[model samples]
Target: MPRMIFVNLPVADLPRSMAFYDALGFVNEPKFTDETAAAMQWSDTIVVMLLTHAKWHQFTDRPITSDGSSSLRLCLSLDTRDEVTEMNRLAGEHGGTADIDPPTEYPFMMSHAFADPDGHIWEPMWMDQAAMEAGPPAQTDA
Candidate 1:
């Protein structure tokens, strides 16, 4: 079987978080969802586990980050730059926030980011396959 990744996030409101993910094109996997936790499937291999604060603490003693503080950001890849833009737009329209940074475009890729209602960052990016095959772009002085 192919190895799958499950990125777990702690959310203050389960239902609201579920809805926000749904808007960003993730499907709810009801088989693993309940009042306190939800399994949002972004792809066949990527599933995000959204757990309420209390439920999350059951698994770890570490405290959840407060609003406006971020430890890490999650990224999702799309097929095209337009898809990246559209997803970010939808995220904002569906109770999330966008424009965390200006969209970036390189010779090989394009990307944008948004934050869910709970402040978890999601970046959607698109890369050119041919450019990838050519190898990483040359490093330049800052």
Candidate 2:
């Protein structure tokens, strides 16, 4: 079987978090979903496990951080820059915060950051495959 990544997150509201992820294009896997947790699939290899505080606590003894602080940001790669922008728009419309940070631009890439209702940061990005394969432009002296 191919390796997959499951990002588990502690959410204050399970239903709300499920809805938020649904709005952002994740499909919920019913077989792995229940009252305390939901398995939201982003791609064939990526899944986000949204768990209630109680369910989360069952897995860890650490305190749940409700303070808008994050140690890492998850990223979703799209096929086009417009899709990245659309994701940010959907996040804001679905009870999440959009544009938590300014958008980033590069000769071959574009990205925007947003946060879910629980303050989980997600960055949507687009990159030109050909440009990436060619590597970054060589640095030049001013």
TM-score of candidate 2 versus the correct structure, residues matched by position: 0.96
Clashes of each: 0, 0
Q: Model 1, 110-136: lDDT tens per residue? A: 999888988888899999999878989
Task: Estimate candidate 1's alpha-carbon lDDT, on a 0 to 1 scale.
Answer: 0.91
RMSD of each: 1.3, 0.9
- Give the per-residue Cα lDDT of candidate 1 at 128: 98
Mind sharing the TM-score for model 1? 0.95
lDDT of 1 at 86: 98
Where is the poorest 10-residue window by lDDT in model 2? 63-72
Candidate 1 — which pairs collide?
none
Query: Candidate 1, which segments miss by more than 4 Å at Cα?
Result: 140-142
Question: All candidates' TM-scores?
Answer: 0.95, 0.96
